[model samples]
Each structure stands twice: as structure tokens, then as C-alpha cells.
Target: MKVHLLIQRTFAGLNTEYTSNPAIAQLDNKLFLTDERSVVMQITENPVFSFAKNEKWTCYSFIKRALDREKRAGFYAVRLFISSAHKLTNVKDCLLTIAQRYEFFIQNNTPSQEYTDLLTQINEKAIIEKERYTFDIESIRKGTYYAIATAENLEALFADERNEFVEKLYLFTTNIDSKLLAEFHLHSIDPLSVVKWQINDEKKALDKLWLENTAIPVFAKKLLSLQGAKLYFQLKGQQEKRELTGTNELKTTALIIDDADKCITSLKINNTAVKPQPYFELYALATDTLYYTLKNGKEIPLPITAKLSTRKLIVENSENALAKLWVNGEELPIPTGKKFEIYALTTDKIEYTIVGQAGKKTTVNSDIKTLSIHLPNRGQTINDNKKSPVIDILLYALLSLLVGGIIGYFYRSNTSEEDISAIEQKIQEKEAKYEQVKKELNSSQILPNNTATKTVTSTTTNTIKSNNTTTKTTNVATKTTNTNSKTTK
Candidate 1:
């Protein structure tokens, strides 16, 4: 079941990809697969590299070698264009099936309905093997599933699948209209690579595809050596405004985040968790380069797995009195008393409950912009700490007294003209009243009762204290009752 895809030797950064699904090529009804045709050099290594001469000589030598090799080794071999998953248990039947399909198409220019039904049945019943190779009539292994790689000085046909930390690949080209991914020269495929890009000398980001197949694992190793790269690619859909209905089966743009550096403590895509291939980069691209339209109506070179980071969330609370914290309806495990800068999205709903005699819940949505999560003090309730009623009343009373005293002190301290005049008038009136009282005492001879003059002189005193000192006032009044009989003096 070996097949060949039309590709060309490129002269810059190489990109390798493949696909088992027919929709990726936008040819669900029809598929194109071929056998290894005429070529000159070994299909794996670029023959141009053999000649360290000028670029022109390099390409010339490579193609010449391929042509020579094809003439020497070309033979009729059984190749297949299968759409189903199957094992090569019976090689004779499989080859016959391929021949039948090819012959029928050559005669009718399209597969008959019966032939299409057979293809579907084969795909369904095929026992897909992991090695990606098919056994011949002699049980010999041949790469049945493989990919085509296009890059600088390299046009290779390999069967090994890339299992690395490559999430997605971006193929940038000046040729915005070029639909197919091919070598810069070949024209046999439906659409060829006529795209050009104005890249700089540093090559910050050249026209890159999803996975550099072997290059990614090599880069993954390098990334591990450098403690990992924060680079990422996200899975995207092919349509711009496609609804996210559950039935719409979305595919990953690229595949695998092969833990090059082991920094990713966790990984999830669209809610499905996937493990990364350790010590590798991205799995090799299975199909050709794909393009997806985004919501902005712009054609992005995508539908590949890409790099995206998890949002950070930090938890802080007084005494760390937090029990359960729910985020977006999911309880997020918060370790006790552990100082860590965790990450989560801010748009996600955040709520928490305190731990104590009464566990109360609270929200973490005060500052959505800032990433910090600070919970209230453990004892601090949503309605502040409850105080005793007595204490509250005392506090209020003290506050009122203090205010009244302040007002009185200020009023007494101010010697306004009006206050002075009022005081003087009172003093004059008091003096006049004192004079009148003296006259009355002289004219009326006001007297007290005279009885045995019980002069039991009792001294009474009233004391008023200010700060720490006391002022005393004493008053004495004697009353005598007159007796008609002489007092028994």
C-alpha cells in the first residue's frame, strides 16, 4: 500500500506533513495517491548536498542523480490508493484491489460506485498497524503510510511519523493565492509552490509549515537543553464563522507538545487532555499544508495545533483560612499554606469559601484585570467582625460626649463682643440686685426663727472635681424659734 505524493525539492527551510483524512485536501469525493515514479537520487537524502558547489550545480546534480536511480531501479510494484484503515495480512488481494481501482479509473476517468463502496469497506475493515509499513507477498515490510517533506535542498519521501512537541505549523508565502504546498519548481500536483516570501537575513520566522518533521525533534532536544521554549500553537477549525455544534468534529492544527523541557505540568485541548511526546517536538504533518479562515474573514495558514499558555491565578488569604475554591463551576484545588503563583483565565468565574466554625463563600471577581487573588481575613465575615452590643453603645456614648465637650470648650474659649456685653449686663444687674437686697434687709429687718437658738453648727460642704483637683463650697444657716415662756436659761 505504498503511495507517492507529488512534491519538489525546495531550497530553504523544509516543511513535512501528511494526512489520513480526505477532507484536509478538500477532496473528500476524490483522492490522489501514486506510486514512486521516476527519480534520480536516493529519495531520503538530498542529492544536492553531495555537491558542495553553487546552488545551480546543487539542484542539477540532485535531479540528475534521481533520474539515474529511477532508470536503474524502476520496476512494476503494487501501490495502493486506499481510503480505509487496513492491515497488509493478504498482500496479493490488496495489490489486486489497487490494480482494479487504477484500471477502472483509467477506463472510466472516475471510480465506479461499486469501486467506491469497496474502498469504504476496506478503510473500515483495515487493521491499521503501528509501524506504518505494509508486508509484501513475501512478508517484506514496506512503508505504506508516509509523508512528503519539502525544504531547502531537501525533497524526501519518508514513512516515519513525527511524534514531537510540534503543535501547529505556519507556512508563510508571498504568494497568497497559491493553494497547494509543493516545491518551488514542480508542476505535476494540482497546485504547486509558486509562493515567495520577503524574509530577512536573521530569519526570525521563515516560511514555516506545521512540523519540520525531523527538525522539530532536533529542536525539541535543543529546547530541553535550553530549559524549554515557551513557543506554542493552538488547534483551529477550517471555517471562519462555523458554529461550535457538538457534531462538528474539529481536528488539531498540529499535533503533540512533545515535552521538550518538561515545563508543562498540565495540558488540555478543547477539554480533551493529551500527553506530550517526551524528548521530541511535533508529530510529522500527516497531510499537506492546510489553510483555515478565522472569524476576521482573513485566511490564516492554519487548522494546525498551536501554542497557547494557561492563565495565572495566585491565592492569598489571612491565615490562609480557605477551604474550597470554585472556578468556573469547577473546584480548583488550593494547597494549604503553599506559596505558589498558579495560572488561570480571569474571565473565568472565581469563588471561594472560608474555613472555620462557619464556612462562608466569597467571590474572587473584584479586580478582573489584576491576576492576584486575595481572600478576606478568616474571621472577617462578609459583614465585618461582629462586635458586642455593650461595647458598641459605649463607643457611641463616648463619641457623643466627646463631641459635646469639644463644642462647649470652643464656645467658652471664644471671647466674642456679644458674649462680653451679655456678661457685663448680667454683672451690672447682679450688683443692682445685691444693693436692693441690702436695702431690703435694712428696711424690712428680715429675721430667722429664734427659738433656743439650737446652734448646733453643722458644716456642709459640696466639692466639684476637675481633672485631679477638687473645689469645696461650705454653707451655714441658723434658725431660732421664739418661745412665749421664758426659756429655762
Candidate 2:
């Protein structure tokens, strides 16, 4: 429920100055506050109260006069805009409380912030302090609404227009107890004249206890009449009762298991614990939807059953979190301090994969009741086994090269120019002498030159570059001659 508050100050021979917490539109202010009927000119025994509604909003206005020397100077109009379903009685006490406080502020000459503070308090009280049952009202079809409420004497607001209330009958149910008390307020554009009411297909004239408010008999297996209690109606075609019970066992076949050891653990639904049976055939409700709580304190509704009925899969991540786990290309969030559980219905198979596992897909047969998977640990992601070896090898090679470059840099930086020159000269001398010795050995080993020869060549070259220094070495390219006539020397 949302409450929009607007306050307007109107004095004789002066333009109306208005302020609203949520900033109501000028048209709404004119309709609910600045209008002559809403503004009280004189102090009266009873405060002026009125209701106005538009296409999108309904306004409740209360006017209270501030007295100066027992003479009426001006008046303040407090208008509340809310959903059409809420009644003025719901906020009457709060309205009076605010009016009395305003009277105090006027007498004491309080600042403007006090008004803002008062509006904030009232808004908070209406939204947070006052508690109301959360009802799931769904329109099944034209003129037919299916609602689930937790408490008795639950009143829901519906439009009185023919287009909105096209059907003659509406259905309601309560899960807390068999008894369900309901009131339907058929509101129209004009509140004074609401359409007449009737009961059932008989067209019996159901008396309107108040304008736009009517109470009908409670619907049960057996007909029962009570004040403000409307009877539940059966589905158009089905004979079975559509009554949903909180604890009554509808069916028990699904199981929740640990992924690590395939052991069954106790189940917790919405923070309530349920012990498993001996064979772990957990009792499940005959409902299509279930909720999973995320680690970030958010609840996500997931489907328990798929299109097909026979094939059912109960999947849970008991050992690891499912934040990065993907099922059929959909990411499954990890539950906070609980195992992530789901009852999925499938036609053939359920395909799932780890996020970083490089498309390593796993398939579970629809016939199988349980699924085993190694989910990623909390705050961690699954690594791809196929890509890890190459990554490791590259990392090792890079580290070796980096270390060698650093050593070479420091050695060169510490050496003088003279020492470097001396080292280069010594290396050149050693290379020249080695080449001369290699040439003499090659000449001595060659066979006689008169025969036809076949030549074979082998070459080796090595190069290392690091830290602004490059060294290249070429090994001897061996040439062997195989003659037709051997040992002809």
C-alpha cells in the first residue's frame, strides 16, 4: 500500500500555497485541496471531510481550521492520495493525529521543516508501522478473480465498472483456516451511486450494508452464511476442491540430496525445517511455484514442475554455492546459508554447466529423480581443465624470461664500460681459435676428391635476447661426402 500526502494552506484573499512530500500534480491539488468544498472557510464543530478520485488515484481530504484570537483566519487541507482499494477509515486515526499536531504547530509558530517532518512520520507509519496481510489477487479471466489471503474478514477493492467486473462471480480462498471472511467494495467513478449487488446465480438481492460495500455468505462444501464472509466457489469444470493447505500432505516423492556424497539432508522451506523420511521421499505440495533465497537476501521464484507430469527432477547444491552455475544456459544463484534446492519438471533432459568450465555440459535424464554435480565453491569460479595446462606452461615460460632479464639488467648496470669491452674481445678471440681448429679437423677427415660425392648438411643456431643484450651462436654446419669408390686416397 502507498500513501501520497499533500498539504495546502489557503487564506482569505490569497492564492493557495501547497506542498507535498511526493509532489502531487497541480491538477490533483486543485481537485483534492484547492477546491472550494475541500477548503473550510470557517471553524466548524466537525472537521470537513471529503473523498475524490481520478482515473489513477483516490484522494481523501480532511480540513482543519487554525484559530487566531478565536477568529477564523484560514484553513489547512490535508489530502491523502492512495490506491482506490483503501478506505478512509484505514487512515482516519492517523489523519486526526496529524491535524491535532498541526494545530499545535500553528499555535506555537513552528517552522516549515516541522510540516515536512510530520508528513514523513505519517508516511512511515502508514507504510511500515501499520501491518496488513499480503494478498495475492490474480485475475483468472474476465469478471473472475482468484485470490489467496491469510486472514479472515479480508477486504479487497475492485472497480465497479462493467468492463472491470464483467463476470458475475468472484472466487476467494484462505489457507490459514477453513473459514474465510471477505468483503468486496465495488467502487466506481462516482462513489455515491454504486451498482446494485446480488448473490449467486439466483439473483437474490444482497443488501448493501453501506454504499459500495456488501457482504456475502461464505462458500464451503456446505453452504454457510456469516457477516462479511463470502463463500468459495469451485472451478468451472473441475470437481476436485482447489483449496490449498499449508501442512496437509498433497504428495511426497521428491528428494533433496548433497552433491558431494549423494546423502540426503533435512530440508528447510522459507527458514522452516522439515525432517526427511526414511527413504528420503520428501513430502511436496501440489504447487507449481517455489522460492529460492539468494545469498544477497533476495527471494527468487522458480518453477517446481514443468509441462510434463511423470518426469520430475529434484536438484540441489548442498556442498557448494550455485552463484556461477548454469542450468540450461540459465544462471542459478546460491542461497544464503542454505542449500539451493529446486523441483524441476522436464520433457527429456536437464542440461547444466559450470560457468568457466569451457562449455563442459552435463545432462541429467528426466527419469532420474536426483542430480549429482560439483558446484563451485563460494566466492570462486570453476576452472576449465582443458585450458589449464597451456596457461600454466605459458606462465612458467614468462616467469623464467622475466627473471633472466632482471639478472642480466643488474649485471650490466653494475659493470663498467672498460670491463664490457674486455669481455667482448676475449669472446671474439675464443670464437676465432675454435673456428680454426674446427676447419683443420674437417680438412683432415675428408675423403679423396676423385669419386662422385653425395653431400649432407646439418646446421644449428642458438639466440638469446634479454635486458637490452643479444647473443647469437652458430654451430658447425657439417658436410659429409659419400664417394662411389671408397678409400681411394
Candidate 3:
């Protein structure tokens, strides 16, 4: 793609600045700055240029207030020209995108960085050799050139007098904007005989002729050559915000950088281990599925492609470690190196517990392709064995005293032979008191247990569409069982 930007300050009615691919259009250096003594041309070349004369043209014009207008109110008129080998279907969008960018440079009073970069590319292309053409009777191709002279006069100029009386020649000069001409006369030795003969005595005519002879035609030809070429434009915030048109579904390249641990045996894509390189520039459609094979040979499909641009994919194994085996509705076991897995299908609900010093538990469902899990060190149990011996002695002494008192009461009741009703009431009261004391003692003790329990529940989300509306149905399966068990000795 090629571009030309021409900006003019309205108050001064002079060209303020221009940024162009020199191949598209070359202008005099005096036109760049606000110099009153400079001989400015009034003609503004059509902003849009087309290769073939009849080609449809699309370009943009903008009138904006000057950034600094303390002395007088003035505006800047900007003209934008774009050309390409492909038809630019999105011309308005491209122009708007460039306008927004150019406006920023104007506001900042700085030159366009994009134009600078384009010039660098142009310079590099200039180094390569290309075919050249000379303007002469023998070198000229079968193409028409402007001429004001009559057929007889043109024939006499190129005629070989020794061989023929007159040479057969042609002249096409009708409605040729002769005064609005350029250096179309330079190719011939006596160009003035054909071009200069008509332009004289009029100051305006001379000026127009000079302007036409400049690089304006080159710019027009550049645009014509790209009549049907297509162009694409992307702004900073466009990617994520733009609707998915599906037009750019073509394959895109992405550079993958694996900053994971070197201990990883392999990182496979499509069941093949990725070769070690500085980075892998994988090419695939944005919607295409690529698989990441787990250690257990389970393949997880991930879409890691981008469109129109090269994206960066960074893989850090320690943070995004894949589990050797992942079972729904079960506690996730962290590998020896404090690594855990946290990724599941978009509709899957995964619940896992990481038993460590803090005993962490969480339930999660991921919408993205990858998820990271960081596990801390496993939990430990502290046993107070020294206090256990003392507790055992106290328990035995209490049990012995309770047994002796019950026997003494039963013996005294039998020996005394008091009222039978009174004796029964006393026995009931004593039994109730003893039960309460035992309950209180049981509630006061705390013991350490080296066991972890996890309840697992698996859930799947399904969308059912009957007609226009979509209904979401969730199915859940629960498993209640102890994951880890240890009996105290």
C-alpha cells in the first residue's frame, strides 16, 4: 500500500506540509513550509488516484481547526491518497483509520512515524535493480504521448531525410490540458517545438504548465496502477472490540515461547513433540483446534491461533502445569514439585482441594483454553503424645471412682430397706447426674487428626435450543466419600 498526505493552512492558502511515498508523488521542497516568497501552485491534485482513468476512486478530505490559533482563527485542510495493487474495498474505514492517526501527529506538531517507516521501506526497495526505459524513436513503446504539433510537423521531426521524403507519424493533443502540463517534453530533443509553441503571453498558463510538469502525473499513475487492490487497516483497540466478520478466517501465525521448566519431557502439539527452537511460529486458522497432549496421553483441544497478525503465546509449566490424570469430582493431586492443574472444558465444573498448611479448597469453571494452579506444601499434623499419657491416667481414675460409688449405693439400698419409691427416685437422679458429667468431659477435649476429607461434585452445562431462545440445563453428579482416612492408635 502507498499513501500521500497533503495538508494546507487555509488562512495562508498555502501547503503546510506533505508526507508521501516519493514514488507516489514528488513535490518541490519549498511547498513544505509556510514561506510567503514561495511560488505556490493553486491546483490540488485529486486526493484519490487511480491507475486506469475510469477506475473508481476513493479518498478522504478533512478540515480541522489549527492546534494553535492564538493570533487568528484558521483551519487545516487535509487530503489523503492511497494506492495499492489490490482493490481497497474498505476505503472509508482505511481513510478514517489513517485520519485518526494523522490527526494525532498534527495535534502534537510532529511528523508521522508511519510515513517515516514507509520511506525506509521505499529506500530499501530502491536498492534493487529494475528495468529502465529511454524516451526515443527506437526505445519508445507503442504508447501515446501528448503533442501540440500537427501530424506533418511531428513526422518531419522524426523523419529520416536520406531514406524518405516524410515519415508516417501521429499527434494526439485535443483537450490535452496543454497549459496544465508537466515535464512531458523532456523525453525529446526539441520538446519546445511541440509543447512550448502554444504556451506564451499568459502568466497563468505558464504557471499551470509548470505545475503539470511536476510529479503530479507520477502520483496519478501510482493510484491507477492499484485500482483494484484491497487494503486492510487495524487500530490499537480494534481487535478485541471488532465483531467477528469471519472474512479473515485464513490461517495466522503465532510465535510460541515456552518459558517452562526444562524438566518437562515434551510439549506436544497434534500428538507431536514441538522441536526446540528459539520459538515456534505456528500457523493455523483462528478457529482451528490444536491439542496439548497430557502425560497420560489425553489430548486437550485448544485454539491458539490469531488472524492478520503474529501473536505471542507464552507457556509457563510451573504455573500452568497439566495433570497427569484429571478425574471429575475428585480432589486434584499436586505433583511432587507443588504443581496442580486447573483447566477444564468450558461447560465442566471442577472442584478440587489442595491440602496444605492452610487447607485450600475451590470450585472453578474456565471459559479460556488454559488455567493455572499453584499449590503450597502439604499439611502436617502435630501430636501431643506427652499429654496423652496424663489424660489416660485421669480417665482411668474417674471411671474407677464412678464404679465404686454405684456399687456402694446399691448395697446400702438393699441393707437399709427404706421406702421402695424413694429408693427408685434416688437411683434415677444419680444416673442422670452421672450422664451429664460424662457429656461435659467429652465436650472439653480437643484432639489432632491426620486425615483430610473431600466431597466431590461434577457438573456439566448444556445449552438446548428449541427455536429462537436458548435454554441452559445443568446436570450435577455428587459423590460423598472420604478421600483420605487414618485411624488414631
TM-score of each candidate? 0.23, 0.26, 0.20
Model 3 has a clash total of 17
Displacement of the residue 349 alpha carbon in candidate 2, Å: 45
Q: What overall lDDT, based on C-alpha atoms, would model 2 receive against the true structure?
A: 0.39
Candidate order (lDDT): 2, 3, 1
Which has the better TM-score: candidate 1, or candidate 2? Answer: 2
Residues 388-441, candidate 3: write the lDDT tens digits.
Answer: 435635654564455445544554444222333344455456446645655664
Which ten-residue region of model 1 has the weakest summed lDDT? Answer: 456-465
| Candidate 3 ranges with C-alpha deviation above 4 Å | 1-256, 262-289, 305-446, 449-489
The alpha-carbon lDDT assigned to residue 223 of candidate 3 equals 13
Best by lDDT: 2
lDDT (tens digit, per residue) of candidate 2 on 260-321: 32222333433444443323222233342444332223444444432212233445555543
Candidate 3, TM-score vs. the true structure? 0.20
In TM-score terms, which candidate is top?
Answer: 2
Worst 10 residues of 3 by lDDT: 452-461
> Relative to the true structure, how large is the alpha-carbon lDDT of every model?
0.30, 0.39, 0.32
